[model samples]
Target: MKKLQRIFIYTFLSLAAIVSIFPFLWMLVSITNKSVDVTQGRLLPGTHLIENMKTLFATVDIVPALINSAIIAIITTILTLLLASLAGYGFEIHRSRGKDIVFTILLLSMMIPFAAIMVPLYRMFGSISDTAPFIGIDSLGAVILPTATTAFFIFFFRQNTKMFPKDLVEAGRIDGLSEIGVFFRIYMPTMKTTYAAAAIISFMNSWNNYLWPLVILQSPEKRTIPLLISNLGSSYSPDYGVIMSAIVIATLPTALVFFLMQKHFVAGMMGSVKG
Candidate 1:
């Protein structure tokens, strides 16, 4: 009976693994095949890999779109890490009345769907376009600013911050470090794992964000990877091979970020749970 149970568990896990990986495998195979071949659901790799890549590059401004996405993702990640960490550290380290209430309100904001605020956000950006064109509509700043630091990130950091030792903050303060110095030199270094996890989440979110960028950006040159991919599929006769290639390219950065920081991310999440 035990042997049979073990066999069943292994079989279940094997099936789950296959199901999870099949789409990525199929996408990889699709990139090598022609559009008709892809539509026909061919599972084997084809000889059209270079042809598909060449066609994708020759036809689209993928490079600029990549640059735009990288810029937005990197900047948003940095801002998120800095701001969320600061807020989290303050919330956890400094004692104050009404702090919990404020934090509660911020967390509650997370429950409100972005769709509810989309119209107002659009109108606000539109109103400021003439005064702050750099951050207004049609700019990458417009995309980054709205998503730079979300409540979820703040809560993530705050939860993780609870596990941090308060004695270290006191030690730094006693050692003649200013508040800013304590944070920059002590808190930041001690919380490397949390930062790594937050960076991965923030970068991925910014890189893949579509709706805000799609609505705000007007110029073709301002398109991010998601927007560009949408356009790739919007054509009357879409090239599935090229689209698959584009998707593969688009997925690489976030995948790389996650894989690189995977260990730290797990540790940070575990710390949050322990806290």
Candidate 2:
């Protein structure tokens, strides 16, 4: 019976691994195949990889899109880390009824689907130049602003802050450090793992964010990778090779971020457990 159970578990794990990895393998295979070959599900690499890249670049100005994505992702990640971390620290450390209610409200706000608020959010950013009441209408700022404060990130930071040693806070106070100084110098440094995990997550989300950006970034010149990839997919005569190549390119940064931050992510969660 135990042998059977072991076999079953191993089979399940193998299946799961295959299921997870097959798409990426298919994508890689497709990247090196011609458009028609890819569409026909050829599992072998072709010599069209270079041609496909050339076709993609010729079809869309991918350099600009890549730049736009990088700018939005980097700025959004930084803002999210700073604001969310501060808010999280405050919620955990300050202990006030009003703030608790506000935090709970923010938590509840997450349940409201972005689709439901899409109209208002879009309008809030405004449509044309000088007509919008709020800032960031029809610009990269618009792309970065909506996602600047990720709720889950804020929640993650708050939960991590709960593990923060109050003794450290008091110690800082005794050493003549202001609250802001303690947060910047002490709490921030000590929570490196959590910050790393959050940074990777936030960057990936901002990088891959599609729906809002799709709706907001109307100009072809302002397109991001996701938008560019979508554009490639929707071409009148779609080039599967080119699309797959774009997918690979689009996926690399997120993959790199996860790889670089995986250790820190583990450390952060472990620290959270200890806290």
Candidate 3:
């Protein structure tokens, strides 16, 4: 009976995995085919991959857009993780009524739709442009600054931090480590899976962030991959092949990140459950 159950589970999982990966496979196949062939639902590889790539580059400044995305995502991820972890540690370790109230408020803020706050956020950033402006309008900073720290990530880290061993922290302090030192040396190192998990999630969020960036970055040159793909789609005569190629390119990094961090991500979540 157990063997039969195992067989059924394995079969179901294999099917589910194929179902999940089908769209990615389709996208890759479509990238190689020409517009007409793709429109006709051609599933086979074509010789037009190079042509599509060339046309994509010709139509848009893809290299710069890719660079822009990488910079924004990387910088935002680093800052988000650093700030969120610190905030989480603070909330978890230093128990105070005020901090509890603040954390609750922060979580509540996440429930409010981003669209509701977008106008105020736009005006605030725009005001910066109108006033002391270097890293304002249509800049990478505009995109990264608004969402450098996410409430969800803060909450995630805080929950994980609750599972962190307090004894290790005490030991570090006993060895003459300052509060900051203990966190940097002891806690940070011990929470490897949590950090890895958070890193991938935050990086992907920043990488694929569309709405706020679409509003903030108003220039062709400043566009990221998502924006670039959207613009391509809106053109009078869209090229499916090139668009597919662009999509595949845009998607690779996030997929790569997730694959690398899958083990750590699962371990981290399990650890969180233990707390």
lDDT of 3 by residue, 1-275 (tens): 99999999999999999999888888999988999998899989888999999998887788999999999999998999899999999999887999999999998877889899989988888888966565677789889987888787788889998889999989999999999999999989998878888887778888899999999898788899899888888888778898889888898997776677778666645544454
Q: List model 1 lDDT by residue over 81-163, tens digit each.
A: 99989998888788576898898899888898998999999999999999999999898888888898788887888888877
- Please give each candidate's TM-score: 0.93, 0.90, 0.89
Report the Cα lDDT for residue 122, model 1.
Answer: 96
**What lDDT score goes with residue 179 in model 1?**
95
Put down candidate 2 lDDT per residue, 165-270, tens digits, no spaces.
9999999999999999999999999998788888877787888899999888787888999998888778898878888888998898878766777787565445
Model 1 compared with the native: what TM-score?
Answer: 0.93
All candidates: CA RMSD in angstroms? Answer: 1.8, 2.6, 2.9
lDDT of 1 at 43: 98
User: What is the clash count for each candidate, in the order shown?
Assistant: 0, 0, 0
Instruction: Output the better candidate (1/2) by lDDT.
Output: 1
Which candidate number has the best TM-score?
1
Residue 128 C-alpha lDDT in model 1:
95
Cα-based lDDT for every prediction: 0.89, 0.84, 0.87
